[model samples]
Target: MRGKRTTTGAAVMIGALAVTGLTFAPTAAAVTPTTATINASCGLFGGGAATLTATQNGTSATITLSSTAIKTPLALAADSITSKLTMVKASGGTTVFSGKKNPAMAAQSPVTVGPLSGTVASGDSLEFYGGSLQMTIFGISVTCTASAKQSPGPFVFD
Candidate 1:
């Protein structure tokens, strides 16, 4: 009976050590991209509304702007539009990543931004600014421009 008790205690200690070792074992660091989709209303004069999808991997990011219709009082014929998207640091208001896209009417497309010189850390803000649309309506060409408000975000990067 004594011999059996000693053997059982030894086995229990070994099992405990194995579990402890596993708990402290080093794990391979994984680099996974974080993605966020943000939507904002630009009002009638600005462009109605817009949706932006941003993906961040390390220091690089890709931004996609879904085609949003512009609303104006004018009877428009054709439009040439471009929008610039930026990731700004919330603390300092520094733009970390910037990219532009000239989207077709009612189309969704991805615009790859950059291997950003500045890091887009946690707790950053994003803005869609410098938007211009050139429209040829009623045989006259007109250019309309507007800037979207800065969206508060933590455009996460893993």
Candidate 2:
């Protein structure tokens, strides 16, 4: 009878643990992130490419733009240039996420933008626009604006 009671107690404990395990299990709403690559160019006289990556978690997103190398006709310094990254809906042309500040071009470091709130689904467009850089080269101020856009393409969500 003692063995039977021990077996019953063990079984009850196992049942309790099983129930507790279910409570701690991950639910369906767990974080699942999606990512996309961005490669675009902008500017006229001295055009530069903006290479960036975008990651989306639910309705929040983050964009990281890597510093780009520029080729221009004038003697320019990286500090004089500023770049901005944006994401927009392809169908309705609504701006979803825009970078808050324009970082200098010569930073040579990755610039991160967001946790911007938006529904970033498949087929959204990415844009990179740089404000014209102005600097006094030999007592003359030079300015140039550059912008690039990526077309909506196939994207998969897991």
Candidate 3:
């Protein structure tokens, strides 16, 4: 009986150690580029010297705009980053197209805001693609001023 109890205790301790090793061991965290898809069903606007707002999946986003003399002599307020989205007449400005995640957009063409079959202009897309994330945000804030030379400005999402 005493020998059996000793064997059982040893087995239980080994089992516990094995279980702890598997459960509590630190894992090697690897950063991989996850190709996740999102449904961009919100419309973004280039408010002439105003802030643009986008909302989807109960999340909201706001991007600041700053003009830089429009580069091609276009009448822009002048700000940091690429204010020249499109060379259009600035009549319609820019807008976001609603579409599903399609890899073809990244490979085939000049990566517009959304899908191709839509009214959104090629230049009229969110500023996120310019090395920032308009998505993956829950809240946003935008500020606009009339006397200010710079139109909209940098955006911060939480």
Candidate 4:
């Protein structure tokens, strides 16, 4: 009876470890191509080429946008840009990621914001062309939209 109990305990321990390993393995794979490009238009604030970078760990993900083409109208303080990124899912509907993440910048400096957080799923394809990026700075609101489809196609998450 003692020998049987020892064997059972060992089997349970191995099973638990296997489960834990499996749960964590996919998180390391990350989303592919990590970076995408878009030609954005922001009206009076001006528009230009922008880079969107992404990272994923399991269902959690983040995206950051930076554009030398778009310049800040004034110097900004860190975490002062109230921004929301809306993306169209290939399957339909939209997902929005909003955050206040920015580095302090001098007047007319390139605009950049976020490592904004959102939830994503395996096989999810998202694009910015049909959506918009809206940002609020110093009581003034600026909106940017992609002029065409993002390069290298839509972001396909793993």
Best by lDDT: 4
> How many Å off is the CA of 17 in candidate 2?
9.1
Per-candidate local distance difference test = 0.43, 0.42, 0.28, 0.90
The positional error of residue 86 in candidate 2, measured at the CA in angstroms, is: 3.8
RMSD of each: 9.8, 8.0, 17.4, 3.7
Ranking by TM-score: 4, 2, 1, 3
**Regions of model 1 farther than 4 Å from truth:** 1-46, 71-83, 96-119, 122-154
Model 1 lDDT at residue 123: 43
Candidate 1 per-residue C-alpha lDDT over 53-131 given as tens digits, one digit per residue, 9 for 90 to 100? 5665555555554433534443322233333344544455545333333333322222222222334554445443443
In candidate 2, which residue ranges exceed 4 Å CA deviation?
Answer: 1-39, 70-84, 101-158
Please write out the lDDT profile of model 4 over residues 20-107, one tens digit for every residue: 9998886445777789999999875689999999988888889999999988878889999999999999999988878999999898
Give lDDT: candidate 1, residue 128.
Answer: 39
TM-scores for every predicted model: 0.38, 0.40, 0.24, 0.81
Higher-TM-score candidate among 1 and 2? 2
- For model 3, the superposed segments whose C-alpha errors exceed 4 Å read 30-158
Greater-lDDT candidate between 2 and 4? 4
Candidate with better lDDT, 3 vs 4 = 4
